[model samples]
Target: GAGVSQSPRYKVAKRGQDVALRCDPISGHVSLFWYQQALGQGPEFLTYFQNEAQLDKSGLPSDRFFAERPEGSVSTLKIQRTQQEDSAVYLCASSLDGPLREQFFGPGTRLTVL
Candidate 1:
């Protein structure tokens, strides 16, 4: 895809189930980010990866949440033991350099944990 692309645009999971969300960023983009957006709130940063190195993950809410960009092009966000609170829109974005530059966002994957 020419832009950031996320799979499973919508997901419904049972409580305590594990889920993995995939993100394919724009070709050659160096910066990738993961964000979580609640029903009425804006997306909140979860992590940031520059190339294949994860430079920042302080925004991740808990140890159950993990994100990685192994090869710098594809990224994945995994949520273990999904809780009701984990339900939200998981967004993926990519920029040419860093967050300071304009980011291209993908259609977020909406997760609903019941």
Candidate 2:
């Protein structure tokens, strides 16, 4: 794709269900990041991957959240045992090298836990 693209622009999950959000970044981007955004707040960083290596996951809220970039291109963010509090927009972004570079953002997957 020309830019970052995310799957399932809108997702509805029942409580306790698990959801996986996918992201396909620009062809050669080396940095991928996952973020969670609540209705009225800014996006919060969840995790970061640099060319298939998970470099930082300190921002993840709990054990239920997991993100990976196996080949440094496509990435997935999984949320386990979804709860009402987990309802938010999950965003994915990619940069050329590191966090310092400009990042391209995907449309984001909005997950609603019912």
Candidate 3:
């Protein structure tokens, strides 16, 4: 019963650079989601995937952001051409299968752009 995990815990990048963040969800889970949380703001849904199929990605701010859940488990979020406004905590969560199910979240990957 492994829990969700994120790497780097923190990332500092120069504006216009590309950054990739990783998330490892619990074993056997079928649903995953990525969210962005700005300082003093609520986490906003960025994308969702059921297994390797991406269900939604309308929340991604722009083409600069991309995500994928290959093999229906581990996921990665990549932000290209980073900007100061892009600095925030990127969170990943996983659930068993429905909206009613509880989603477990990792500590998050805090990104800082300079």
Candidate 4:
């Protein structure tokens, strides 16, 4: 892809339901990241992948939040048993390497848990 792309710009999920958000990063990028952004707040890193290896997942709010980059390009973030607190914009970004380099971000998947 020419730029990062995320599916379902907005999602509405009832509490306790599971949802999966997709992301297609720029072609041949080596670093991918998932971030959670609450309304009126800055994005916070949720996880990072260097190629197919998940090197960091320190910022995931809880066990219900899971992310994966199986083929080093496309990735998915799944939230299980969603809670009201989970309502936020889930953003995905890709870079040539890591934070040391500039990254391009997708518009994001806004998840609203009710």
Candidate 5:
């Protein structure tokens, strides 16, 4: 089975540009999560999805951040207006549907907002 994957492993965007990041979770794993990690900080949870339903998005930093899982599978995270402060590694992880299970993470999409 395929593991999680992210596209354009690295990106450089000018300030105010919009960028979209993609994630594909392991087949049949029903829980998916998106996170952001600053240079020295641990990954911070951005949003969580159970199946196709977005259950929590409290961690989205601003209105510019959005995520979706339209088919109960592959997910996307979009940043509407990139800023220098938004430069960070965005990660996606998935696991068996529920809390407390160990999560398998993808190699993150590294975004540089210049």
Candidate 6:
């Protein structure tokens, strides 16, 4: 019934700290997506899940980045060994069952590593 929502709208993590970002997609949505947006750049797809299965995760920058949609409605993106370069906005989006590619995005979780 609600749109996608992400926790910790802003986060500050020291270098090497691990972080977990959460997302709650709209109920009944068939598709969920996670994106990373760097300053002054377009968002990059990190992963995509349909239902409880992760259909694609080719965009994850490294092995440290992991995503899961265990129950198909809530998703989490975990980043291990946070680095300064990992600072960016993590955005979550969800889409309904349709032929067109359309997704509603969350406000984004801004992570800043010091």
Best lDDT among the predictions, by candidate number: 1
Show where candidate 2 strays beyond 4 Å: none
- Tell me model 2's lDDT, rounded to 2 decimals: 0.94
Quote the lDDT for 6 in model 3: 95
Question: What local lDDT score does residue 20 receive in model 6, on the 0 to 100 scale?
Answer: 97
Candidate 1 structure quality by residue, lDDT tens digits, 15-104: 999999999999999999999999999999999999999999999999999998888889999999999999999999999999999999
Ten residues in sequence with the least summed lDDT for candidate 5: 95-104
Give the runs in model 5 whose Cα sits over 4 Å from its true position: none
| Clashing residue pairs found in predicted model 4 | none
Instruction: Please provide TM-scores, in order, for all candidate models, with all chains considered together.
Output: 0.97, 0.97, 0.96, 0.97, 0.97, 0.95
Task: List residue ranges in candidate 4 displaced over 4 A.
Answer: none
Clashing pairs in 5: none
Cα lDDT, model 2, residue 87: 95
- Model 5 quality (TM-score): 0.97
Clashes of each: 0, 0, 1, 0, 0, 0
Question: Which scores better on TM-score, 2 or 3?
Answer: 2
In candidate 3, list every pair of residues with a backbone clash.
Answer: 51-72
lDDT to native, each model: 0.96, 0.94, 0.92, 0.94, 0.94, 0.92
Candidate 3: minimum summed lDDT over ten consecutive residues — where? 97-106
Q: What is the lDDT of residue 5 in candidate 6?
A: 93
Q: Distance from true position, residue 11, model 1, in Å? A: 0.8
User: What does candidate 2's lDDT look like per residue over 17-41, in tens digits?
Assistant: 9999999999989999999999999
